[model samples]
Target: MGDVFKALADPTRRAILDELQERNGQTLFEVCTRLISRHGLTSSRQAVSQHLDVLEAAGLVRTRREGRYKFHDLDTSPLRAITDRWQLPTD
Candidate 1:
């Protein structure tokens, strides 16, 4: 839970998760290029690496290597856990 909050604390990280939701199991370059260009926020590859690390630690995302490239995917179960615990008001 702490990791989830930590991963979401940064806007960039949240944006990364959003991208993963749209297209799961994408290579690192694909994910980074989409987010960086879409948000008009330039980030170094190293910066993207940091975001992935946090997200993985939070259990909100997962990554696996396929030959040369690493593919990342969203692990929405943890997010569902967090959201389920929240008390959102219904209109």
Candidate 2:
């Protein structure tokens, strides 16, 4: 989907997804921390939150709130559409 591609287009967003892939179900704070420590991304919490918003809109990231904490998880099923759309024959 266009949204998926657009979401994956950004380096920062891709890094965020990579972080989630490495450790799914991370809080916003955790994601921010890892992005800085692991990926050396200096984005602020507000900016990273906005990137999460884009990923969420594209169905690449899912968010759920429990009590006072919100967790983010990666969803790669949407990527299947790309493979399916251009799948090669095995004949």
Candidate 3:
């Protein structure tokens, strides 16, 4: 949970999550390009890669390797836990 909060604290990381939500299974290059074209973010690929590392550490993002390429996918189960904890029961 602490990791989730820490990962969500950064705007760049949030943008990365949004990108994944918009289009799952994106490569690092695709993510960097989308962040610039769609989100107007000026972060470099290396910086975005670091951001992805943090997101991966938080369990918010999952990765798969295909040959030499790695794809990033979003995982929202941690977020579901937060929602489940706070949802009011119906009478």
Please provide the root mean square deviation of candidate 1 (C-alpha atoms, Å).
Answer: 2.0
Model 3, residue 59: distance off in Å is 0.4
Report the C-alpha lDDT of model 3 over 1-91, residue by residue, as the tens digit.
3488889999989999998999999999999999999889999889999999989988999999999999999998888766687886687
In model 1, the Cα lDDT at residue 71 comes to 91
Count of clashing pairs, candidate 2? 0
lDDT of 2: 0.93
User: Could you list the CA RMSD of all candidates, in the order they appear?
Assistant: 2.0, 1.8, 2.0
Off by over 4 Å in 2: 88-91
Clashes of each: 0, 0, 0
lDDT of 3 at 48: 97
Model 1 local distance difference test score: 0.84
Task: Sort by lDDT, best first.
Answer: 2, 3, 1
- Candidate 3 local distance difference test against the native: 0.91
Best by lDDT: 2
Model 1 spans with C-alpha error above 4 angstroms: 88-91
Q: Give lDDT tens digits, candidate 1, residues 41-76.
A: 687888988888889988888888889878999987
- Residues 1-91 of candidate 2 have per-residue lDDT tens digits of 2388899999999999999999989999999999999999999999999999999998999999989999999999898878898997878
Model 1 residue 5 distance off true place after TM-score fit, in angstroms: 0.5
